[model samples]
Target: MERTLPKPKGIVIFGFLLPGILINLFIIVIPLILAIYFSLYKFTGGIMGDFVGLSNYAQLVKDGKFWNSFKNNLVITGLSIVGQLGFAFVLAIVLQSKWVKFREFHRTVIFLPVVLPAVVVGFVWTLMYNKDYGILNKLLSSIGLSSWIQPWLDDPGIVLYSVTAPIIWQFIGLYLIIFMSAIQNISSEIYEVAEIDGATGLRKAIYITLPMLADTIKVALMLCIAGNMKIFDNIFVMTGGGPGDSSTVMAQYAYNVSFGQFRLGYGSAVSIGMIILSLLLVLVIRRLMGGTNR
Candidate 1:
């Protein structure tokens, strides 16, 4: 079948887009320009000093702490891909099943965490992860698995993962909803055909659902990457990037440099580096995921 439609008018399109363009100009473009400008100078205490071009960038290149924080960001991004997306995939499938009871209620419960403040999640999980007199240890000891109970917030080796837990757990319902929405949008005729062809259960998921949901999965992965790379509040409330900086991620690290240490220029440089690294990593992932395909 052939289809025809009225062409969009240029004046009307521009009028519709003008507000968004102006907003981005102020919110994104101007700030980006200012960041670049500040990165070229030595600025501190709300004062701009000597313009040392590329020196801030040079110093950042030699900054071990910056690199360490970046490494932690990568770790979080990797874990989030598996933890959030993988868990959401399974949960969405379970909830979508015909035999499930009170599925709407379950979905509402799952999604509730998404609306909670990151600070609240952080504080709540911090108590949950406390080494002494905490719920985790009590449960483990009750199950006769006290050895499995960990110093979640204390140990440097595990603090990063501990802080990562609530961060990963918080938005899982969101990705689950995205996946479920995608799954629901799929045509029933396709499933009927799959049934006729003896596809069901795991076979149905693998052959019909997954392939059909590939685009949605890509979208979910992109959201996961962005969220993990830019995460701050919850981890800050939980760990403050500590246990000797073991839990430090790039965002919080830059913030500490900017505000805590008052090294505005250096912080700007770190922020720029984070922006670059995130773009590069996302682009690499997109390439690997065959992003150009429909």
Candidate 2:
């Protein structure tokens, strides 16, 4: 006699997931497919009646402006990730210190910037960096350091780094929160044991706390990398990729190609390039971080 098998529960599970699947396909998959399809054609003034094959990609390789924007993005990403993570880690350590009074107040103050809108942050920084009447120049002049003042967003040499400082400042609080949460999750008993063993404050922090926070560090680094890679709003609002393309990043480049220049096909190519670069960086981060730990 043949035995009858039970109906699999996968059908019910799939039915539960079907709506989400369809939504993702419509929202993400369809647009991605359209972008790839459009990347092979030439769009003139928002019209894409002509097919250009690989010419657009070839043009990107030879485009000096595109490469310059690409390099600017690299610099911005590098500075933002390093500066944000370093500052956040230091802030986390400070907040976790038992000797620090009013820890809650300090944390609240530090995290205020993270909740502020990006456009607002950009405008505030733009005013602060204004050459003549800006507070930064005023402070420098007050200290009799007048010779050090320069155009913050106008100089091509320092514009990219200057714009990055505001972006880093805005997000540092979020990363600090992440690190502090991770630090709190660590068992106090471990600290007690270390202290009983005559461990100094620095020794306990270096050997116990830092090592225990490795997983958190990895997560924070990944976040910083992804966030910096897609930086657009701050650069757009502050510099507008101006001062001779001094602070243009990848997203801005793509925006210029698609909307500014009305070359949707080439813009799609640039977007695809950015996507690929971001993916590669994510993979590199995973490898460097040992593929995540529980």
Candidate 3:
């Protein structure tokens, strides 16, 4: 007779998931519901006012500042895709190469920034971008390229990109580690076979390693989309959407509207707008990537 294993009891499974369920209910579900409910009213002065029925959202549609911030968010997201994911992929490939030495050291150094507090990274980069005495301008001066120096944080034209740079630098290591792990899981025999067939490393990476990493790449792209959509702390600490709202993102705008201007109803609407937009973008990405996590 063949041996059989017993299935877990429903109560046991529910017991195991109880803490997570409760946490989500209190932390995420409840807040989201309240935000939606509050969004339907003219909530202000710490009291829910008369129902406005999407008037706040209607105003948000015409709000120039909100759209400007959304555009800035798009720019940051695009740059993040190119900078963070792109560089991480390249670094992962290089580190996986047999010719590279001190792989562990390189990994550690690259990932060190990811573990640092976001506020700390922001402050450090802000200091580095200081035009008067900052290291960036000083380095340019030292290299006889002083013209390259600009008011990095103060200039509206370049402030967005300036804030974006530190964010990219801080997070590259995370995706680098992710890709490296995915690459490691690719079988050695596949590469060996490609090598035996006189295929070059580049060809093997393109044809074999890349195809094998399809699912992992999809996951990475999704993560990038979601994370960049709501990016806040780094830009907040660095510029506070400064130089007259040049680098403001959706999250920061919602914050300013809620706390800065004391417009809780509109702020809740903005918050809901962010959630809807993020979900829609994620859905589009999923569809474009073939709509399967497999």
Candidate 4:
């Protein structure tokens, strides 16, 4: 006689996690594993069969172009984070003030850019920065500053910073919203007590408001760092990593290596490196911010 068997316990557990597991495997784990595998080979003429061991990584260490791209990324990330978060916090504070009129209208106007597509922002900024007959140049010319106008995307000196202008413009609104929410979460009682104690506006901000917003600052910093580290679309559309690769970040460099030059192995190595860097940065940021009880 045939006997029926009970369903395994492990199967039930697996079923519970199946959707998330499948998504992670397909979206993150599989691609990571494939990248590692590809990084061990040397591709030539559409062939990916030759294994090169750790040579790809070794070459990465000696690659000036990779370092240059990495430096550009660092600069861009630093500037974007500082400019975006600093001004966002200021704007949040200003909007929270009782004296500010039409707060909702101001918030809506600031947030409009956050909802725009990155490509659209890039194209719009490209037109604004165009040297010849572009709005920016025309405006400067009208103001008798035409000599100061230059090819924003073509100048190696200013290309990275110029492209970053659009990025900062697009994302500052999101951070502003984050800061505003955090500001609103602060209790009115605390502000009232501070005022009763003869605390000035600046003093209240320093002692009470900022201290309460510490956790929000940490979260905002993490998001800003991660987003800036992996920046691509804005740079791609605005500059195409051009003007002698002045604005090329690791993502753009990896794309160029993999698809543009068919150096799949090198590109995979770059991708893996980027992943490692991202993980390290996240861990470091978490540890630093974890000290705050909030």
Candidate 5:
């Protein structure tokens, strides 16, 4: 038997949600509508030019640099799923173990980077990736791995990965915290029962913990996709899509086109493209993961 509570009156519910609804309308919905409207015209230099219709979008379909940036974004998203979510899950498991000491201290230390500004993180990593005075090269040289040291930010081949490293490092702690909270919500009796059944820690985690964390993992994946799709600040400060636009992502590409090149209309189209692609990716992920629709 279960008790049922009365649903709130419609007006009361609307009143309670009015502020948030208004804020989102002003901040997100309105701007998005404007971007879409601008995307259909030839807007340049703060002036509306010829009505381009779908020409900008047609151009976008054939834009090599835009596609390249899209590829980079996919790479970053994949790396984030593997690096941030994967590492965080492992670390969270370790922290939850009985033998791990000073768990709180470790949690706090890991999460410290999450509080720092993205620009600051980018600047710090940029200095570290310097070929000449950078500590990375120095450390490699000291350890007799001199041959392994190549330009982290200069080479187009590895610049994408190099920029991605900081993004992963900065956000791992956030996912770790999320995983920790999810793990805590699992029943202690489940672990106890598993132990009684002679299940090892690894086996228990695989069979029990993983199954229970499916929803959390789904949410984390969604967050990773959404966040990386619009990632700008870190890459902006670190590489500025340099080495000849080798490491650019969609957001940066959009920014460069809009403000940097004064192609506001095309930039808006790029932005709309980003939103569509992001939504598509999220849908694919949801479908693949057997989403909450059931």
Candidate 6:
């Protein structure tokens, strides 16, 4: 008698995938739905209160803090893109040249910051920026430029820019690696041909490298924008969103609203608004990139 082996059933296949799907729904989807629901009501002591019906959103429009936080995010995003991508691109090109010596050592030193923990970087920089006993002030004093030293984290006017420094310093290595790898994948023959045709230096970069690097640059820009949008750890560690919330970004503002001041409903609305804004901005940016596509 011939015996046939049992076949795997559709139920078994679904059973194998069900756990992950359910867990994702439980962890991500449920909270998202709850946030949207809570955005419509005023959260009270241990419970949601009467329906607010977009009052929270209206409050967002009228709130000066909300607008300030948004403006800070834009400034941070713009400056971050320029700082990170500009340095990374230059480093990638320079380091790729045969004339550069100890290339591996330079790469290691530069990329070292990328591997360091963000929390540690933040705290270290915070200490370095301390006005009374900080290295920064000490250096200025030694050079007889003592008047140049200001309370880095305490000053409202320049604190936001100061907060951005560590962020820009830390991420350049990551984008450098990415841009370098993209540069490498472009066949060497094209570059050689360009050189033979008297196209070198900035001509080769502007006409050849830039056109070929369109996609990679777009990815880098998107990552930079998204990261700046959700930035928290460094600012939180250094400033605690303080100096009168001068350095507050959207994420920090959401946390302060939700937990610090106990305004859960308004916080949820802010979060929802942030998500919508992020999505819209990304779409707009991506569309712009497409229009300039080579």
Model 3 per-residue lDDT tens digits across residues 12-105 = 9999999999999999999999999989999886666999999999999999998898889889988998999889988998899999999999
What stretches of model 5 exceed 4 Å from their correct place? 1-13
**Higher-lDDT candidate of 4 and 5:** 5
Cα displacement (Å) at residue 215, model 1: 1.1
Per-residue accuracy of model 4 over 101-135 as CA lDDT, tens digit each: 99999999999999998888988898899887689
As for model 2, its CA RMSD to the true structure in angstroms is 4.6
Better of 3 and 6 by TM-score: 3
Instruction: Report the number of the highest-TM-score candidate.
Output: 3
| Cα RMSD, model 4 | 5.9
lDDT of 1 by residue, 1-294 (tens): 878988999999999999999999999999988888888888885568999999999999998998999899988889989999988988988898899999999999999999999999999998988878789888999999988999898898988888888978998999999999989999989888988998877888888888889989998898899889988998899889998789899999999999998888888988899999899988999899998355
lDDT of 3: 0.92
- Please, what is the TM-score per model? 0.92, 0.89, 0.95, 0.89, 0.94, 0.88
lDDT of 1 at 101: 99
Worst 10 residues of 1 by lDDT: 39-48
lDDT per residue for candidate 6 within 244-287, as digits (tens), equals: 97999888999999999998999999888888777778889999
Overall lDDT per candidate, in order of appearance: 0.89, 0.87, 0.92, 0.88, 0.94, 0.89
The Cα error of candidate 1 at residue 247, in Å, is: 0.6
Q: How big is the positional error of residue 154 in model 2, measured in Å on the Cα after superposition?
A: 0.4
Candidate 3 residues lying further than 4 Å off, grouped into runs, are 1-6
Model 3 error, position 153 (Å): 0.6
Q: Using alpha carbons, what is the TM-score of model 5?
A: 0.94
What TM-score does candidate 1 reach?
Answer: 0.92
- lDDT value, candidate 5, whole model: 0.94
Per-residue accuracy of model 2 over 11-79 as CA lDDT, tens digit each: 898999999999999999999998888989886544566888888888888888877887887788789
Off by over 4 Å in 6: 1-27, 291-294
TM accuracy, model 4: 0.89
